[model samples]
Target: MKKPQKAIVTFTNPTVKERLKPHLYSMMIKPWRMIKNTLMLTGAFVWLLLLLVCLYFYSVLSKVPDLEKVPFQHVREVAVESVQSKIESKTKLKEYQWVGIDNVNRDLLYAIVMSEDGQFFSHKGVNWDALISAIGENIKRRELSYGASTISQQVSKNVYMRSNSKSFSRKLSELFTTRELEKHLSKNEILELYLNVAEFGPDIYGVKHASKYYFGKSPADINAAEGAFLAIMLPSPRKYHYSIFQNKHLAPRHQRKLRRIFSDMLYKEYISPNQYQSYLKWNYFFN
Candidate 1:
């Protein structure tokens, strides 16, 4: 009788939904787990990349020479090693020249300050207004051709940066070093450093050397036109200077560019009307 009762036991079938509940939960949770893991990995990679960038920047900044040191303080016959290396590499000259700010003509100094940086004396390290305008100009042109570097920024680039350096990284380094320069050095000191490091001719470096190399005279004795001549060479010394110095002739295009720049210099009060007229007159003599 007990065996017969056991044979009558009923069988119950589970619903399809009930059977799929565990698998469905697993399917839903699987994608969430994968997404969470992917996000964690991406975060780790980003952090590592940022860390590498910081280390690289630190190494570059650490190598920068102290500004209060002997060579910088006393104004030696040659530029700092960083500057010297760049100049020598570019010019094929073994020496990096230097000159005192006192020895540089006011015309040359004013020309540089006005042409390169209109707010040299007023801005701290960066001329934000000029930089913003330059950025706008670059955006409009869709090219990074405009450099809104102040005297302090140029000095920092010459003294602490590589010649081949480019992009936003170069700008960031220049900004940091420029701020440091402005903190420790006066406007006059920054201008002095710029004059000593800037390339004025195809091979000429520093105001003193450029003066003697191109004009066969002292920088202190250069006329307004000569100063303007040197200022215009900054955009591309090789492009402009090779024609004037080697060919003994100024191109008509260069002359036109010079006239446009002179207008800006006059408006900025970098030169007087008389000086402007002198530069205009000097253009014909550039033959």
Candidate 2:
């Protein structure tokens, strides 16, 4: 009976901190955990994007052959828009020939460089100024009127793209391939390859074939006027070739364009005064 009476319990109130500690700690660290996870995700995404770009670059450049070792071809085939185009057009391919740099005259090279890209020798691949200007021009025109693609870019486009389709992906690939070309090949080599692959007429491809088809001479033997004519033909080869080959004379507008190219060549000191005079007076003719 005495032991039962002595049995008693004491009670104490708990503090606010002790009651709320676990919830408060979790609230404090929630934002930090979210931030850490977000950062990790962003980093992984960037790495994946870089890996895709590197793989694309390699894929674009892998198909190109070194001119110093193997000859490159301009694979030409006019896709006739017909139900039986493929079956009927078994041999729609045009002419293409690989010409070495040493076999081509320096004047022709200079003329092309002057007409296509004035800063061809200095710039690596892209010309920002001309490109910006072209972008502005195209925006104003509300059409893709201008392309400031360097000779290197043209080479990349002609070789890889195969068609004149101006898709955004094609342009991006051209940029990547142009840089790769600069890294792998010399300037002269790039020019040589371009001269060989560029479209000169509806059916003409490469300077070697172009020289013989248009002028009845080799590229090395082409004069300043002929070189300038060839340079101007680049923008619209089929459109420009309104000639005896196509059973029509050269358009007056094309002649004017050719003269303008000549003027540019002279102003840039790519040709002498006598050459300029000769370029102005010479008849724009092809064999």
Candidate 3:
């Protein structure tokens, strides 16, 4: 018998080898790749649809202006009572006493602006510098140590959203509401809303009510020292307020820190030197 002839396969061109290699790979991997790509595309599409829905609702909600015609003082009362009850129940603490905002000292408002949000008037809805600084601080601390929320953002959160957890969805909602508020309200309006809605204690909402509950006065009537004290209470209402009230050691330090914030506000030109001096000389006697 003749020797068996051996059949050999070879590519005639280098390009053919390259082409065949890809074909072989496709035969092996195409199904998995296709499934992965299809799943990714589906997820992207779903996210886009959800974003559009949120935007649509936001636009519709923005068109509806706040129509509560009652004086802000009345709103302060309601907020105070509501917050007091909630705090008491949530913490199993004593009943938070209600105090109307009408008795609050006006100087306190200036103090708050000076301390918490010095650039409250100039920024539209966000302070990029503060946000950047806060981000940097968080990075350095390896934890959340600061916040960049503008006064308007805070109002949107305090009034409409629950102050419970910081989830992605809650943050998105806050951004949406803040953008809407910026479009519909002026700076002063936003500040007023914040002053009327912010939490001062376990249940105290708004400076007006907070003044009455803490200092036995209205926000408009608070003096510079009192205002500084109140401003000091803003960073962490639950922790600082209780510490200042109950822990004698913390009270002086807290007051001094508040005064420094006030001075910084003046130095930054957020508050006039005249306003700063007025508060500097005012004796802060709570009660």
TM-score preference between candidates 2 and 3, better one: 2
Candidate 2 segments exceeding 4 Å error: 1-95, 243-252, 285-287
- Write one digit per residue (lDDT tens) for candidate 2, span 1-287: 55566756877787998879988999989989999999999999999999999998677556554434333332222111111121222332433445688988878887788778889889998998998999999999999879988998987777665556777656776787687678767788788767866878766767777888778899999876788778777888877777523664656786787777778778878788888887787865433
Across 1-287, the per-residue lDDT of candidate 3 in tens digits comes to 89998998875756877879988988879899999999999999999999999897776466433534545455445444445545545532343433333444455666777777778878878888998898899889988767888887787666666565565466666767777677766666667667766777666666666777777765667766677777777778888666775453345577578668777767766567887777665544433
The C-alpha stretches of model 1 lying farther than 4 A from their native spots are: 1-10, 15-20, 63-71, 74-97, 128-146, 268-271, 283-287
Most accurate candidate by TM-score: 1
- Candidate 1 pairs with clashing backbones: none
Error of 1 at 93 (Å): 6.5
In terms of lDDT, the best-performing candidate is 1
